[model samples]
Target: MEDDALILDLQPLPDGIDERLAAQLTFIAEADRLKTVLRASPLAAADRRENDAEHSWHLALMVVLLAEYADAPIDVGHAVKLVVVHDLVEVYAGDSPVYDPQAVLDQQAREEAAADRLFSLLPADQAREIRELWDEFEAGATPEARFGKGIDRLQPMLLNWLAGGGTWSMPGATEARVRAREAGVVAASAALGDAAGLMVDEGVRRGWIRTSEG
Candidate 1:
């Protein structure tokens, strides 16, 4: 609530803001571009697609609320940081939905370049901190990172089910593919994973999600 001073769209910045703070402010302002990076997943309303900012915020919230269900003990704050920074690269690289077959092409190069450009807007130490968090999230090796990932995978699936199979109805988004994509998160958190599995099953029964057989 008190961080309004950091919001670039708002009038004049705080008095005595230093060069370091100025850079940080600039990065924050630029990161706001994420709001324009639309995702394949639509909102529960199905009226419009959600943006990267909405996805990141929702992903962080999901991690916080579902921390208790993680398969291993996790630092919730660490997980939140991971989710918040993970997608910031999309501001520059643009979003490529995972189910998109073309998404894999040069994604790492694009995102890495985006990260360098965006995070560099912040002071050195701060940039390193965020970049490290982003890398950890990408690695998905740490317990916290894995849990963060599980929630990331779960968020859109929940939205899809709520939006009457939003992206699940896409030609490439078959039941088998969706289930396999969701399985990674299920391995990370039993409770949330179980819920995801059930939702996929219901989606199939509702004819919202299709199978190869069909």
Candidate 2:
């Protein structure tokens, strides 16, 4: 996309503010946009869709409380950080529904562009740091990232169970399909995975989620 095509929020910087502070403040304000980006999953206890900001916040708290159950040792702090920024790009590119393959298509390219546009609101060094964190979360290569990824998947599955089959009750959400989608939850922590697996089984038994195709 062309630079001219990008509409920026240009407001007067506070007098005598340093370049770094100005840029950081701008990025902070821009992050507020995340509150408006709705996601596919509904809030577990609420009647409405969850936004990117709420999802990130939920994951951050989950990471702290559930860190102990991780398959391998992880830096809890780092894992929390990964979850917080993982969905920041959704502010620009919007949330992608995992069950909808079309939504996930070109996901990387779209998110990278959003990351560049959003993270660049910070100073150069901070931009690089924030972008690297976003990349690490996306890669899910490191222990922290993998654990974060696991928690990310677990949250939605739990929501579906809590919401009487929430998104999973929608078309195309078969038992086998959901299991495949949630493999990462188990990969992150066996205990949580086992618990979620049992819930999925119940969901299938209750006819809230479909079983394998005949």
Candidate 3:
């Protein structure tokens, strides 16, 4: 409880701040526009450009509505917090295509740096809490992370299927793309798999998606 004792125990960020890091604070405000500017994942509706903040709102809403489908019991409140803050980094890092191979490879570096910078803007304790939640979401280790990821995968799959396979019909969409985008959720929850399968089936039945050629 003493000041000197606290200083002895306290640690600094794993990666210290720099000029590039400092600019991230101003960019964090752009997260408020995500819903309006960024589209859902490419598997979903490509026509819409949902901004970053809106995407977070939708993810939090999904966490609330779909908590029962989680593979294990979860603190939905914690899951909501994770989802709400997960992409706030995008306010600085910018959204990348989920299926873009090169983009996917580069994503972690870009986002990790963004996370370090954006979360540091808050008061020390609050910054740590938000950064830790963001890390938990990224690690995908806990029940909450798995459940949060399940919804994350499910939403775009559902949206794409509903939108008549908006991006799925593009020339390069392969079974591999579908698998890559949706498989993590399948691994996380059976109910999510079932829901995603139903969406895919509906997309085909409605002539929105073509079955793969032999």
Candidate 4:
């Protein structure tokens, strides 16, 4: 009995748990569950439509390549991470049109609710980290957030241009409207503005956006 007790005591226990990692994994798993509803915007390429996930991925790519254009110096990694998580609320809020003043008005409320519900599902610490990042992006108060916003506006402008001004040709879309939508990039980074200018030029050349109607 004494020998048996000593042997049992000598056996090692499993390692202590990493609650942080567990929470992170939980969030990552649930992240795929987000749904992105379209707002009458068509895709640039295939007949198939773009979803929120695709949009997030595209923006992440842009974040990497466009870091040099940020209005202020920023952590490119954080900027990319911000973009990856930004529209994740859209998975819940659905894609509200930038041109729809009413929809835009309601977007903040919807997205905040979605963030609460979605982030709460993760482990507590991970939830806090992710939610903080999401909040920073919404606030647009930091350099990373600004750059993220820039990419966010730039992507759709490019997509619409490629789609032959799918939204631009819609009843109320005008150059002024498009510029307003694209101008958020300036707040985030000047490079984003440069990119938007290039996109606007392309839109004009492709006849997707009107040029001289000012």
Q: Top lDDT: which candidate number?
A: 1
lDDT of 1 by residue, 1-214 (tens): 2422334646656778898988888888888889989999999864999999999999988888899999999999999999999999988788987767788687999999988888887999999999999999999999999998888889999899889889887777888889997897787998888999999989989998887744
lDDT of 4 by residue, 1-214 (tens): 3411322234433457476665455555556644435545667878656777888888899889878777688898898889888877665567777766677788888899988877886777767888999999988899889888878888877778678777777655667778787779767766668778787767867777764443
lDDT of 3 by residue, 140-160 (tens): 999999888878877777667
Model 2 residue pairs with clashes: none
Models, CA RMSD each: 4.8, 2.5, 9.6, 10.6
Q: If scored against the real structure, what TM-score would every candidate get?
A: 0.90, 0.92, 0.76, 0.78
Tell how far residue 140 is off in model 4, in angstroms.
0.7
Q: Give the TM-score of candidate 4.
A: 0.78
Quickly count the clashes in candidate 2.
Answer: 0
Displacement of the residue 146 alpha carbon in candidate 3, Å: 0.5
Steric clashes per prediction: 0, 0, 16, 2
Q: Tens digit of lDDT per residue, candidate 2, span 1-214?
A: 3432332335566689887887788788778879989888989767999988988998999999998899899999989889998889887888888877788898888988899888888889988888888999989899899989998998888888888888886666778789986788888889989988888889888988887654
Off by over 4 Å in 4: 1-26, 201-207, 210-214
For residue 169, what is the lDDT in candidate 1?
78
